[model samples]
Target: MEDELEDRVLHQTYLSFMKIVTRLTSSAPHDTPVSYLWKMVRLYFLRSEVAVITLGIILFIMYLQTIEQWSRTLLSRLSQAMSPISSVQRMKFMEGSEADKQSWELKGSLSAAYAIKGRRMHMEDRFIINENINNTGISLFAIFDGHGGEFAANYAKDHLIQNLYNKIVEIDAFKEGKIISTPTKDNAEDKPQEPESNTSVERKISFKKSVSTADDTSKKEVTDPELLAQLSKARPIITREVRPTKPIKNVPVPLSSYLDKGKINFGKLLTDEVLAADRLLVEAAKRSMNVAGTTALLAIMEGNHLIVANVGDSRGVMCDSRGNAIPVSFDHKPQQVREQKRIEAAGGYIAFNGVWRVAGILATSRAMGDYPLKDKKFVIADPDILTFNLNDHKPMFLVLASDGLWDTFSNEEAVKFIKERLDEPDYGAKSLTLQAYYRGSVDNITVLVINFLDNKVASSATQ
Candidate 1:
């Protein structure tokens, strides 16, 4: 009974107070209302000093909340800048556009790929299928498997191809009319640019072409002959070739190129571009709270020539004319002798936990991002580049995929599976992912199959 009576009295008092407040605001002088409000506020809260303390706490919490929200928005904007889908949508806005036509034209060559977020919370893999790049009859297909997040993969997919194309054009490879013909000549010359994955490379490429200094005291110069800045936004830039200080000749041009005496040294092109992209991407990632890394496996088909650049565990295999499987990319594992030695040289170690991992955090030794590891040289982004001429190998089809698919399928097994289903609408890409999922694969699965039966055959006559 006492509680009910107290509640009723409090409610009545509140109603009377509101009426007084409304009346005073409407009729009383402004100064009078201000004084009245101040007195009323003191009268209500003076009974308990705890009320003032509580109000102060509430205001401080609100201030902190505002700051946190503002920071979240800022981080999101930076993340969006890494790979802006809105910009792409704006560029390719119309249907049946040039980009669309080119995409279909490449699809007509019987290339199909599919990605699925299988057994993973978020799908981090990204892939690209582009054809007739710069009207040079060059087609590029790539797969990027992200480990920690998708930012590194997406950034690489957006910038690496453009950078590589600009580098190729910089060399006058197409302007000079160097055709890939039989009895090819690979000058085996040292590239006139900075070394591949030079440790001292500035982690940043300028928006405009500018000279980078190595040491002010020594007066040494480090220049990217290609300018190394190929982002679309950078329009006006200059290019100057400096005599290279380092010579890269240790890794020989691979088996197919040597056997056929391949002409162009695409190795240098892939090396320089991938290394530059990795450095810039690392810088971008370091700014964010989430630092990631990705494996890159890229294939460039120009005329009769095919060049592949690989970093990490993603695999690419081709079916030769004899129906035998030929690997195009090699996986980088921490257990490998060379990789182990490099890790140790950099003051890092690898441990086996179901699989060999660099620093027990990453399974692949070479990847695009993955911060402080890259700083310590415990992990590198240097790619292994290999070249082949389609005329010499006569590939029936090629299969490229992330390690998820390779975990359950071998090179021969994948080639035979695709060969049997070459006529399928998806060129066996969908089926391959499904098969891997069924075969106990636990990671994200992505597969690409390019059938060469319908593609233009490269021969000496065509050249």
Candidate 2:
């Protein structure tokens, strides 16, 4: 009975399979692709479970590959949005230096941010920190804010320190009678001179000519401390290089004497070197076919003296022990009376577009390059120099930043902001820069913070 039942079931199954095959053949006049598909489907069902697992693994891998491609595309787009081809933000840099003779130390950090215009450009700002220049204990720190192009700023960063050092070498040579003539030409007539008026908006600068640029349009500002924290991690502008040194020569007097004698005329030396750099820039621009401009703000600390030289709008502010903000350098705007006189005297007019600009073009009255304007004899390369005796007023730190930072934070406000973060010297400049960006500054931003509070000269006032 069992055998008969099994035979009947097998016969019924065979009949059902034949009916399916017959229907498939009758539905198509000729063998169609669908018939092959149906045969494959039937084969698939007849296959073992291992085949099904294999197919599932293949599908999973394909899905993963698709997801990976999508992620790469997303990352590529994000990177492009962060900066333009020419202006990618560089990593932050931090270094430390101590004065040779004074009981003070300097800590410096630099970082760059993209401009609001959103082009692929480099950080047009550059800086230098020589811990022990020629091991003289004289530390040099500077920031160059470039506009129109990065050439000027980069050039200044690479050459400015060496130029200043060369000037000092000449001074030493002159003192020792190794060279009869000064390293710089005694071309007082050719150099710019300060007006006798002490009330000039900024100090009377030397070697200036007329020029013009547009000022920034005011915008609603915001603040971003978080952004600043992130910027602090960027790589430095340039790797620290061995500072070029002038070979030690016979000295008629101690090195200190040469630096301090007759106020050492160090201020003049600085001015001369600055003008020399500008000339070099002009010549370089002529060759490159790219005329660019940059603002320079420099601080030189030798023993008890802190000297500052600035061109254009970048600023250097010193915070005293009492937390008072001291303007070591001033912004050179065409709208200022002294700057205006100089600009007009050079045959440049200050036109007002969104803000006061030089000849309806540049906003700054002084810059290192701008050869086209320089050719017109309207824009000039000159700097304002100020000297402070750190012995008298105990200092806490120094802030050197481009106009992007000054556009948002005031002298006092910035000093106060830094004062609150005295514990983290490196973060001082980073925080200020972030604040400027959050405040909606459209220009590229760069900041250098040098903390004096942590030096051996910690003042009771700030403490």
Model 1: lDDT equals 0.66
List residue ranges in candidate 1 displaced over 4 A: 1-108, 168-264, 454-463
List all candidate RMSDs to the true structure: 20.7, 20.0
How does candidate 2 fare on TM-score? 0.57
Q: Candidate 1: deviation at residue 407, Å? A: 0.8
Evaluate model 2: give its lDDT: 0.61
Candidate 2, residues 220-281, lDDT tens digits: the string is: 11112322232232213111122233433322323243445534566776786788768766
**If scored against the real structure, what TM-score would every candidate get?**
0.58, 0.57
Best by TM-score: 1
Q: What are the Cα lDDT values of the candidates?
A: 0.66, 0.61
Query: Candidate 1 versus the native: TM-score?
Result: 0.58
Shift in Å, residue 434, candidate 1: 1.3
